[model samples]
Target: MNPTQKMSLQAIDLVGPSQPLVSLIINNYNYAAFLAEAIDSCLNQTYPRIEVIVVDDGSQDGSPQIIESYGAKIIPVLKANGGQASAMNSGFSVSAGEIVIFLDADDYLIPNAVETIVARWQPETAQLHYRLTVVNTEGEAVGFCPSPGVQLATGTVWPILLKRGRYHSNVTSGNAFSRSALDKVLPIPETDFRIAADGYLVGAVPFWGSVAAIEEPLGCYRQHSSNAWSNSQSTEDPQKLVKRLRWALKHDLHRYYWIQHQAKALGHPTQENLGLRDYMHLIDRLASLRLDPEQHPFASDASAGIARKGIGAVWQQDCLSTGRKLALLGWFAIAGFMPSLFATPTIEWFLLPTSRPQFIQKTIRGIKSLRVA
Candidate 1:
């Protein structure tokens, strides 16, 4: 390991393994088929001190029965369908763990996941992120999502999260947050972010304190047709796909703005706050490119101006590769000049085909297998 990485590990080791109570909050909303496995995973955890809380957001499916079957093993919180954020808020209200991990209903943890997290826990660390393996509906391991850069870094990751525009590095199921951190950022602000509730939490947590990361894949992220985000990929018609993308872009823009407002309210404005401004501006320029390209002759110029600013920020992120940065730059250029191109069905199909390319899929499987080995 490099000297920096060694030192970070040493620091974590110095904290020693103090296995405090951990709360695994499983949020469910009609994911009956996968609910049992998720609870079972928690029940089977290697960690000794854990309280499993299953929050059922008025699931019409048989999920309630399954959660009830867990009986005394897990605390069941049944509430009206107030979305993921509300369910998490409810769960957090009843939880009594020093560390909290929000595990999605469709995803489950590895037996040793909580154990690994506790091993690295320190008094000052606000958040900890680890890798997660992606699985299909049949529970087959597909691939892994690796945090783009500085996976072992144990400090502020706000800048890295902002420059990338999303928390692609850490999945909700694979993250653990200190109770102190949650006290600062949660009850989740009661926003319109249903699917990307984790995004809001992920964005705000780092400001409270340092974020440590583990390179190990400690949980499984199930990608299926029912997933709010993944369901858009199944759209076959080009116009429909474009509409979905537009809606998604708008949704993300709103979420970012909300986080920015939260940061300012909390009086912890960082470079990410400015980054969110540039991102929102970029989205507005792209919208202009799509809506009134003829009226705004300088739309492309405005888009390029914002794109360059974003590129500069992205270029400094160690989590992204050179090619990824260039790809983002190219995407910005396209969004500026030919916004409709992304909306086109042909391009959408090629980029997010129902079946991903075999070579790429094979490469991911190979990488995950190596990690497992």
Candidate 2:
């Protein structure tokens, strides 16, 4: 650690009871190979006073044994297989920290992530605020940020969001949250949303809290060919691709439905959308579905003609770049014939945060004031 980092840790140690220690809650599900690294990264933080909670989602991979290796510093919770959302809900229920953070088992935080996040939390107008931070995996920057008119929900809306790419594509899972925020947004439903649950949780956050952006790389996200969806994409096998496509379609539809729900819930107009790209993609996906013989048992000739017309319209609209247009055309063809491969990007880049000078100036001032006293 640098001298500045050493001093920062010393200062955090000096913070009083008025400032509660942040809790880092990680949801582990059979990723034992990566769990230790994630935990170790938390252990090496320059900021002091963080409790680590690991919820093992019934991993028969002996993940419980690995977590136990950390002894008391890391608390391990074992539950039946209830998926990521349930694991998070379980961790949230037991954590006592005033500020809560959720970290995925495969991801880890940067050295000063907690300190930087805590600095952004002291809003004069509210108890909890949504802080945005940038991160890089393997030393490469992931350029993603929230766009204008886009509001943040609680914690971090990483895996499930429309304007997700605006926050950086390679964001790690260890995002900090204020305790009050969780209290207000509790019992995050353990829905069987194959892909877009994170978006729903984020959209559900109230608009009253403040939103801050932290412009520093705080962690690493390890991506490999062995992930859950990786194999589905690697095969020419029709059944596998079909299964993947169905999951994607259902997930995206659910995401859009919830986006509308949250917009209305917050008294915001449901139709004033930011992700035109997503909307186009949705339409493209829907239009492609007209070709499946099984899906449309009757009127085979009409369905084929409609599919050709829809594909031609997408090509002529030039809604995307040449490559994106071609890609969409190909996807449309696949969706037409195979009727699969439809879903939201687990990590998305919908609307980017406004680059207006006022917001920039405000962010600059806040960051400039974050140095250790």
Q: Give each model's clash number.
A: 2, 24
Q: Residue 22: error of model 1 in Å?
A: 0.3
Segments in model 1 whose C-alpha atoms lie over 4 Å from true places:
1-18, 146-154, 159-168, 269-310, 333-351, 355-373
Worst 10 residues of 2 by lDDT: 344-353
Task: Name the top lDDT candidate.
Answer: 1
Query: Across residues 1-373, which tens digit of lDDT does each residue of candidate 1 receive?
Result: 8999999998887665555999999999999999999999998999888999999999999998998888899999999998889999999999999999999999999999999999898888889989898899999987676534324445876654445454444767978999998998888855666666886787778767788888878999998988866566565554454455556555566657765665677675445434333433454445444544464334344655665665565555555555455554555555554546553322443335564457644643444333211
Q: How far in Å is the alpha carbon of 200 misplaced in model 1?
A: 1.3
Give lDDT per model, in order.
0.72, 0.54
Q: Flag regions of model 2 displaced more than 4 Å.
A: 1-14, 122-174, 194-196, 206-208, 230-239, 260-277, 280-373
lDDT of 2 at 221: 52
